[model samples]
Target: MENSSRDYSHINGWGIDADPKNDPTYPMKKRTNEEHRGYSWQRPTQQAETVEVLHSNERPNLTAVFGTTVPPSGLSGMLRRYAFKHTENEYAHWLPLLLADRINVVEGIIEDFKNGKVPNIFAEKGMKADLQHDRAGLIKKAVIGGLLIGGVVAFMAGKNSNKSRKLDY
Candidate 1:
């Protein structure tokens, strides 16, 4: 067979030295990206069509590339954790300790509440002091409101009393 490289002219610095027809690597129908000299930058037809077909048929044989029947895609960590909690697993030894953590938190809260005091190191203040502070604020507001209403009423009564003392002149 004649060398296909010598048969065709390399146009405009585009064609490569290797030719698919006579080259062993081409093997008749295998896809190769050898550049042709005649291919114009403004209008690329053959290579572009080859690329489009390849892209369209990219997912035809997933197992061919991945070497597995099923792909490796899966849910994220949060969804996995949620699903893991609902399903019973014989291999998960840490699940029991994680569940017990919630109970321990509740027990700590109950211990603090039953003793009528919050567990604190700095200042041991009773819970009633908080209630007393709230009550004091309420009483202060009531006293201020009464003083304001009394001042308005006393001013109005004085004005009416002065009007009564005036004779028609």
Candidate 2:
């Protein structure tokens, strides 16, 4: 496991090993001739030492970034309570603004139509689309293709059979 906390800039070749498959330990220490300066992580380290270092008592959400807090839960609490919360006691402070925007849009559209800015969508020069799909024709084509494929398979199977045909008088 990777210790997602500390900056490993001080440690060189932090989590590398000759054979990662053999050594299933985190921060796989590279054996170097460097003298240990009384550092726990220094010199050729053990798997137990790596495990101990990785597993720290530091709380993840001690500073509100690791998503371990209660109340509103996770980042949602940060947004709703701290960052983007309405100052007022109302449930939805943006409701009025949202409704206003919708009304303004509708009014703008109506105004444009009155001033002849918004042209008729059903105009003679307007581009038309084939909305009426031929569902029956599509189904018929699919059935025909399936039948043809099935017939070919059936014919091949019958033709390749080693059984002798008996002629009835």
Candidate 3:
């Protein structure tokens, strides 16, 4: 390999930290004897597995701490189990998890209704905050959503009409 005489020291801010005095963080960057102290503490005892905890297939065991509240259940739970079967690198693992989250939201709303509680969706969705802070952005999103829904309805109506006309012939 041929060595070229290309000097990068002339560039602005180049080797700025080469001199400890010129370093902005020199004061806070002090190395104490305590800095060499390694992690000597023992790992905490693993939490008891009380619920259906879904973990990545790559992991040998569950973490020391795990959330017990809202254990996996219903259709979303099944989806989560399926996702855990596959490696995290695959889209098969993530797509079902994403779908499961959407299903879980619907399930939550249904569950709320079943419990004689009418959820305040407007407040839950933070629409009031959006109206106050981002009125224009909120309006734009509403318009786009309305248009998309209208277009789908129009297309379905047109397709149904065409099918009915074909039956007449």
Candidate 4:
């Protein structure tokens, strides 16, 4: 085996100690088994195809990730929390397929809650003031309506009394 450091090539200001071409001594900086490895930025053809297959499988593995127990509030909180945590895990390629499937389901639940189909705990917290204002407006309208009706009756009664007095006189 030839030593790569033995052959020295000089370029402008840089000292090239190792052979740029074929190195007989140290073959292509072999990756150590303990060296941390990760999924390539672009997945391999087989891995991409495998991910596609896993996505289409539809086994409802979200139940495994999110668990069966509903959160303290309801399904919305449980799903939202799971989505956030799942997103972080997905970045690490831990649950890309499962998380991708679940993200939409959880987001749909959140949207339904927004559309008033489901009770959204997040909205409920902020809507207390709005609900109170609506109730107060309804009460005010009822009170104003009652007062207007009472005033009309009083005016009619007064007119009747004046007419009766003139006729009697």
Candidate 5:
């Protein structure tokens, strides 16, 4: 009669060829694929090796950008913190769009001045006085545009702050 411990099978090429009776850890109870959630049963040796690799804490966190550190918990919190820190510590940077707008207004003012009208404020500061006088309309227009842009930027900034707070995890 064939010994039950000496029975061996290699159904899906798992390489379990050696006699089970010779190994102390072999001839163990095995589970079917459906019983282990579609995973084949592993030998004791292979399972030990896999467990050792999984328990090792040698891998680095992949979420952090260069020169930044991230905690293992809650990724969204870390991102929000990093963004807030970056924006808060950095100096105010001039945006190209805003600079372009200012340049356009200055050019408009120059054109208006060249039309024989300069702002009276220039003369009030003890400057040139032979300037013509139709600059009031141009000055008022520039001031109104500047104020509108500033208000919009302020409103959007406040709205963003509130939204960011609401999204905090």
Candidate 6:
């Protein structure tokens, strides 16, 4: 062992294994012919691209393992496709992807209703858990949501009233 100018003796367990005889793996320090070799087996076969797999613009080819469950199809899918056109580094790529995710949630809810299944949005959103653990946060969100909806309704009503007045003139 070479002596260093900077002392590491302050550190706990420092130089504990300075003596090779004290080393745990010293007994099993046998070198093998294949010890320095890379992976022995070839890469597992790449999953077949049966569905429309959205890949980053940077990647030349699809990855070995890629998801195929949900292929792009609807409006959200179109936004996602547009998003993928731009580089991942730009907001143009990310913002549309974020918007698409929100849109997909709404789409899912609509699809549930269309299938005659009334989705339990509260349970699905973990509101019960929020109520138990984060009551204040849940209340704050509800208040803000109510205020936003109220403001929109009021604005629409005012716009309708203004149109009605214009018709009377």
Residue 96 error for model 3, in Å?
Answer: 1.6
Error of 1 at 39 (Å): 40
Model 5: per-residue lDDT, tens digit, 1-169? 7756543355564444465665565534353435456556543432222111111122332222222232222333333333333333243222332444455556556767999878565555433322344466656766898999999999999999999999995
Q: After superposition, how far is residue 164 of candidate 6 from its true place, in Å?
A: 1.6
> How close is every model to the real structure, measured as TM-score?
0.22, 0.21, 0.69, 0.22, 0.22, 0.76
Candidate 2 C-alpha error for residue 41, in Å: 53
User: For candidate 3, what is the TM-score?
Assistant: 0.69
Which ranking of candidates, highest lDDT first? 6, 3, 4, 1, 5, 2
lDDT of each: 0.48, 0.47, 0.92, 0.52, 0.48, 0.92
Query: Which candidate leads in TM-score?
Result: 6
**Model 3, poorest ten-residue lDDT window?**
31-40
Point out where model 5 deviates above 4 Å.
1-133
lDDT of 3 at 50: 86
For residues 43-162, write the lDDT of model 2, one tens digit per residue. 433323211111112333132122222233323323343322343445453454355455555565676798989745334323232223555665676689899999999988886663
Candidate 3, residue 43: how far the Cα is off, in Å: 2.0
- lDDT (10s digit) by residue, model 3, range 1-169: 9988787888998878989999987876785655478647888899999888889999999999989898888999999999999999999999999999999999999999999999998899899999999999889989999999999999999999999999998
- Cα deviation of 30 in candidate 4 (Å)? 55
Candidate 2's C-alpha runs over 4 A off are: 1-7, 10-89, 119-169
Better of 3 and 5 by lDDT: 3
TM-score of model 2 relative to the true fold? 0.21
